[model samples]
Target: MPRSATDLLDLSELPAPQRREVRDFVQFLLTRQAGAKKPAASYRFSDLCGTMAWKGDAVAAQRSLRDEW
Candidate 1:
């Protein structure tokens, strides 16, 4: 038989301040877990395909960068 969390941890043995800290930590963990179950926001790179504006010569820019290296 496995021992449950309540049985394994005797919160009564801890001081009042420490107990409150533990309680706050447990609440944080629960909130984090609930958030984890939610689906993450998604992004599409294709949506930004033609959003950029370029004004200079592409090959000239490459040669200029290479010459500096």
Candidate 2:
């Protein structure tokens, strides 16, 4: 889940053992459903759509989406 490579990314910067606490809270946020909230797949599709238009082709973009299943 780390988007970067650095020791400064860990919870050592906190005052106590709150890493697990923070992780749980973030996981809850990711899985939460409110109103028109959608899963991670929706965003992936948006990403694919964006690239497809940029590259002038949508064939590989669609295949990338199917691979998620």
Q: Each model's TM-score, in the order given?
A: 0.49, 0.31
Give lDDT for model 1.
0.81
lDDT of 1 by residue, 1-69 (tens): 986444556799899999878877877887899899999979787697846677999999999999998
Which residues of candidate 2, in runs, are more than 4 Å off? Answer: 1-10, 33-69
Clashing pairs in 2: none
Q: How many residue pairs clash in each candidate?
A: 0, 0
State the lDDT of candidate 2 residue by residue for 1-69, as single tens digits.
656223335777666658767766666665563433844544466655655336545888789899999
Worst 10 residues of 2 by lDDT: 33-42
**By TM-score, who's the top model here?**
1
After best superposition, candidate 2 residue 16: deviation in angstroms? 6.1
lDDT for model 2: 0.61
RMSD of each: 6.3, 14.6
Error of 1 at 31 (Å): 0.6
